[model samples]
Target: MGAVTPPDGFTFDGLVAKLAAHLRARGSLTDARWEEALRAVPRHLFAPAAAWFTSNHASAPRGRFALDDEPAAWWTAVYADTSVVLQTDDGAGDPLSGKGLFSSSVSAPGIVFPFLELLAPQKGDRILEIGTGSGWTAALLSWAAGANSVISIEVDPEMAARAAANLRKAGSAAQLVVGDGVKGWPEQAPFDRVHVTVGVSDIPMAWIEQTRPGGVIVLPWHAGGLVGHQLRLKVVNETTAVGRFHGTASYMMLREQRYNTRWSGHHHEAAHRSTTRISPRTFWDMDLGAQLLCIALVPRVSWYDVSEDGGDSLLLYELDDHAAEGSWAACDLKAGAAEAEVTQYGDRRLWDELSSAYRQWISLGRPGYDRFGLTVDPAGIQLWLDHPSARTWKMQT
Candidate 1:
């Protein structure tokens, strides 16, 4: 945010305008308020001078870009519509090496503007933002709303400190609170809007309790499936909130919402084997709606596609299931095979569950993502198609 003269041809203003045009062409920068906010906030100020950037191309190499070492590259990446990696391995690994878990970063402008438009903060609305990375989004929210009308929270003290310094430089009056965002800042209760940057697996009752009725909560939810979704929920009561999925979003999970990745090979040994008429593609090639249905009905189950013996297969892992441990299933995906092989282990029959969910989707005519809606209430979270009272699945919060 500090005054930094851009290299002759790479004027910062020019870069901002060009980026805005690019986002507009991509159909992301639609709202006038957000476009103005984007012009007001300098993304380069929030990003590190020298850090790694996520590659838009799948085959491109990864490494760090520094203003001092590579000004052109750094400036180019700063203006481009890609996320810049701020820290890796929770700041333990060398971020300059461009290798490690992307713990945090300034989000890509493409996603940032879309989500901000979804939030639709008014001039004087009080907003609560979770995961204040780089303080960029907080500054944007402040611009759309009013000065000091936004309260942003960050769980990491180090990241919070950096964001605070960035905010000062940007002259953003948005208050930064260093704490767990899942708790939802209660001291500033009854906010008009709640905006979350991190991916949420479990819906917190505290968020519903803090927002006044008719308020809105927008977030990227990891609804127990291969894909994550962007959601907008309207607060209907002290204990209830409802909304529908907007689009696909694959964000870094909130620290607490992350699942255990320690998988053992022994689970495959004591498995029950069967053949399912359902193709592995039923899960692997599922459209957004089908995936949402599977995620809703089959809770706490995560899946991935695998290739074995020149054949494709889908693997499922049971997460947070107290009834059993090391629960998993593998379904063969041989092309044009009427019945594929399935191997399931532990107390949970994951293949059976997925197959059942797929059948239900067929019976209901296989709706798309728009037909799926989420509800959070005193009775826990529920996912339903069409209407709230219709066929619904209770999600674990």
Candidate 2:
């Protein structure tokens, strides 16, 4: 790799170099080949002309930045270690318009390199990449695995086209397919690795079937309705894959696997109401370990918290509701109160399940997220602590 010339009308004054050094210092850009790829594939070339900025995952996007409109700010954000939202509400609404979900983004350098490190693609390795959001990671994978070794799938046709153009301009030979990534691109089966860029609630068996034995699949596992986890699984055979969690990662949920966030309009006239000694903070303030355990023990739920009336309130929504339609729960933590009021509006009693999961986690010695591992097979996915067989529970498939 020689000197990388910046795109026309853009001046990257060692910014990629600076970004590389930053990732290295942060211990994410450890591989020499990956570092070279980072230098070769300038992120600016892949970034969109207009995008939204957010300081961190916890904060909402501040405002929009356009390359032609705000060159300096756009350049700075492109080089900095933060995600840039490419579209919101599936391109129907502006990101900063105050009412739209973040549908696409160029993930921060911090998260991207870590997953790439976990992928560890080898030269000439056939790689299948899910969610070719900005085409940046695909380019990097092509650089690592050599030309024509990467096949990337994107669900959104518009995003796919944009990514295809970006890959072409970046000189990456990675093939781009505009289709649902959950299906795993069967035409190109037996891939050496599967790299997912979106959050997956359920591990698609198609991925396992497409991957060659001993192949690795790395993704952001969305579970427990909390912040996701970095999951790295090795295909043990045709029917099974097992791996452990690396750390916390949050990404946009895969479109096909996305949970319904809209409130189900049902009058809770006869809904069960109760009180619990468990405070709302117990749910909202749970560390990553507890959150991961809850994901295993109390699967198929999403939660959100709010500060209200000088206290915290936690709301749980059912994602896999079947018999008990629209099961939901709300727990309120009044300041300086020992017990919290709980309300259940469906048959599933989500709050009770959450409390039970929390107690189970406590009884198991409060293991951290690192101690847990996932086993995905034809029967179902299972979560275990310490060892694969040591205390396992079937996760909602």
- Pick the TM-score winner: 1
TM-score of decoy 2: 0.90
- Model 2 off-target regions past 4 Å? 1-13, 24-27, 57-62, 95-99, 262-268, 320-325
Error of 1 at 249 (Å): 0.9
Instruction: Give the per-residue lDDT of model 2 (tens digit) for 1-397.
Output: 1123444555675767777787888786788777677678888788777777765433223466677766666776778777878778888978655358889888888799999999999998999999999899999999999999999999889888888888888889999999888888999789999999999888999999999999999999996566888999999888899999988888898987777764352557877888898878777768777787787777788788878779888888888533336788888878988888888887678889888988988998899878889899998899888888898889865
**Residues forming the 10-long window of minimal summed lDDT in candidate 2:** 1-10
Residue 318 in candidate 2, Cα distance off native in Å: 1.2
Give lDDT per model, in order.
0.83, 0.82
RMSD of each: 2.5, 3.5
**TM-score against native, each model:** 0.93, 0.90
Q: Model 1 shows how many backbone clashes?
A: 0
Error of 1 at 51 (Å): 0.8
